[model samples]
Target: MAQQERGKRSRRSILEAAARVFDERGYDAASTNEILARTGLTRGSLYHHFPSKQAIALALVEAHGEALRPPERPVRLQSVIDLTLEFARRLQSDPLLRASVRLTIEQSSFDCPPRTTYDQSFEAILALLQEADRHQEVLPGVDVQEAASTIVGSFTGLQTMSQAYSGRADLLERIGIFWKLLLPGIATPGLIGHLRTTLPDD
Candidate 1:
């Protein structure tokens, strides 16, 4: 147990350091030496856990997503709003995610397929869309594929906006406004009223 705990701590430290470096430099520009220096770990130690900068980046993507899994499922419209905002918060707060998202866009501009790092993220988002459908929360006339695409695009836009103002109050402030602006248009009149009354701050 002690050995496992130590290993976990070591990996977390390495990932955190790597994330910081990746955020400061971009995915392609980041150097393993910077990660090692930031992590205070030896070269061999970093290599033992992550074979290369790309490997560390892939791990960062997985770790960033796994770290945000909430305990309870979102069952209501308000819950979905909270879930989205919470996701936005994590994306802005986690350097690894910020870097990976940027990488996803950059790679796409070349007409390249999404890397595994982004594939995982896309799958998670698809699950969120499926959930909204399962709950009948999506407004009528909202096509699943189209809605998914739009939401994913919106999410990407939000991430870029947040990265531009990292650590600023406006990021979350704008995200909240985004959900509020979207909700009323999609939700049924009664549901919209409920959401407005229940979440005035939203």
Candidate 2:
């Protein structure tokens, strides 16, 4: 049991160290050596856990969803809004998420399927939107799937622009603006007025 726990810790260390390198240098320029240096782990140890840098990148990309999963709320639409705001908030402090976002956009640097990250994001948002639809939060005739896709795509662009312009310092504010404009189109008029577009005060 102790050995297994240690292994888990070691793996987490490797992933986090790799995340720092990937976030800073991007996938193509990031090297295993830099990750090892960051973690102070030997080559053999890293290879034992992740055979290649691409494997580490894949693992980070897959784990990105964990950060975005919002707790359930009485108002499902609010939960969806909270999820986006939470993700933006996390990007400011979480290196793993930053690395995953960088890896996701720098798709050409790695062999991981280009659509996998986007598809996962779309599915998660779709589930939330479907729930919102059931709650009558969504406007009549609005296509939840299409709305989910738009949300994912728009967020992708929003974060990319935020990262470029502000290094994500203003991501939360940008997401607030996003929901303000988006809610009117997809959410019921009654629900739109109730949903909070901005992040709650920290």
Candidate 3:
């Protein structure tokens, strides 16, 4: 058990180091040597866990998908909103999440096809919207699938702008405004009234 736990920790360290390097240097410019240096792990150890940089990037994408799994909430639409807000918070601070976004964009250059990461995000949101539809929380005439796509697209654009302009310091605020603008058009009146645009503390 101890040996297995140690192996998990070592793999985690490698992935995290790789995320930081990728987030800083981008996929094309990031080097395995830099990842090794960041983890303080030997070449042999890294190869034992991840055979190639492509493998590391794929693993990071998988991790990002897992991170997007939001906690279940009674109000499904609220879950969707909360998930986006939480993602913005993590994008502001989590190197793994930030790196995942970069890897998804740069995967084509590295011969790693980027479909599962984004598809998973889309499917998750679609499922939430469908559930909200069943609950009558969605406004009349709102197409659940289309609404899901719009939410994801809007968040992605806003997040990219936040990254470019301020390193995401204003991300939560922008995300809040995003929800405020979107909810009125998609959510039922009662649901929209209860939904929060700002983070709870704000």
Candidate 4:
């Protein structure tokens, strides 16, 4: 148990370090040596866990998503908007997530990213949309599967862009654009009105 715990800890450290390095230097310029230096680990330690720098970069992407998973599903459209805004806020605040987003976009790694953990992020959001359908929260005309796929797909694009442009001052505006464009079409008329009313006046 102790060994397993230490291994997990070490892996997390490496991932966080890689995120920092990637954000600071970008992927092509970041070296495994620099990543290891950030983690305060030897080459052997890094190699013992991640076979290569790409693997570490991939792990960083997963870690980035993992750090941002929401605790529970929302009951209403307003909550959904709030939830997304909160997610965008979290992404803006976390450097590791910012780096991972950049890594994912630069690699163009969607449909699949470098790590399996990223799939969990997909599933998490997909599950929310699915649950919304179960409750008939999604607009009646929208196809649930299509809605699920579109929302998930657009979010990937948005997250990729958000991460790629992490330091840009208008990050919130970018996120707002995604929602404004998407929600009008996805939500039922009543739900759309709800969102219009509930989204923080901005």
Candidate 5:
């Protein structure tokens, strides 16, 4: 049991160290040595957890999905809004998520075919929008799937721009503006007035 726990810790350390390197240098320029230097772990330890730098990058990209999982809310539309706001907020502090976003945009660096990170994000939002639809929270005539795609695409642009402009210092505020403009189109008129665009008080 102790060995298993240690292995988990070691893997986490490798991943986090790699995330820092990837976030700073991007996938093509980041090196295993840099990740090792960051973690102070030997090559063998890293290989035990990840076979190659691409493997580490892939792992980070996959972990991005975990960050997007929002807690359930009585108002599903609000859940979607909160999820976006929270993700924007996390980008300011979470190296893992920032690295994942970088890796996703630099998909050309990957050896595999183009990834489905966008599709994954779209699916998550689509599920919430579907729930909102069933609850009559979505505006009539709004296609939930299209709305989901738009949300994902818009967020991708928003975060990229936020990162470039202010290192995402203003991301939460940008997301608030985003929802203010977008919600009225997709949310039921009654629900639109109630949706919180800003992050809820911590």
Candidate 6:
């Protein structure tokens, strides 16, 4: 049991280190040596856990996806707003998550299927939108699946632009703007008036 726990810790260390290197250099420019240097681990140890750099990048993408799971809320539409706000906060503060986003965008270079990340995110948002539609919180004519896709695509473009121009320093504010722009079309007037576009204070 102890040996297994140690292995898990070691694997986490490698992943964390790889995330940092990948975040800084991007996937193609990121080097295994840099990852190893960051982890302070021998090549054998890293290879024992991740067979290749591409595997590490894939794992990073999965980690970010897991981090994005929305917290449940009594009002489903509010939950959707909270989900985007929470992710925006993480994008500003979390290195692993930031790296994961980078890896996902650059997946083509790693020969990874880009849709894996998008599909996972789309399904999560789609489930929430479907629930909201059933609750009548969604606007009368909105298609839940289509709305979900728009939300995902919008955020992806917004975050990429934010990262490029501001290093995500303005991500939370950008998310608020995104929600403000998006809510009018998706939420009923009653829900739109009450939905929180910004996350609460830290």
Clashes of each: 0, 0, 0, 0, 0, 0
Name the best candidate (by lDDT). 2
* 4 versus 5: better lDDT goes to: 5
Per-candidate RMSD, Å? 3.8, 1.3, 1.6, 4.2, 1.3, 1.5
Backbone clashes in model 1, listed as residue pairs: none
Candidate 6, residues 42-158, lDDT tens digits: the string is 999999999999899888878877766888898998888888888888888788888888877774477655656778888889999999999999888888888999998999999
Please provide, for model 5 over 1-202, each residue's C-alpha lDDT reduced to its tens digit, 9 standing for 90 to 100.
Answer: 9999989999999999989988888888899998999898889999999999989988888888888797689999999999998888888999999998888877556653365578778988999999989999988899998899989999999999998999999899988998999888988887777878887786
lDDT of candidate model 4 versus the reference: 0.67
TM-score (C-alpha) between model 1 and the true structure? 0.78
Clashing pairs in 4: none
TM-score of each: 0.78, 0.95, 0.94, 0.71, 0.96, 0.94
Q: Residues 138-180, candidate 3: write the lDDT tens digits.
A: 9889988888888888888898899999999999999889888
Which residue window of length 10 is worst by lDDT in model 3?
A: 105-114
Model 1, 55-145: lDDT tens per residue? Answer: 8777766565563453254445565555556666666566666655555565422232345444554555556656766788767776656
User: lDDT value for candidate 1?
Assistant: 0.64
Off by over 4 Å in 3: none
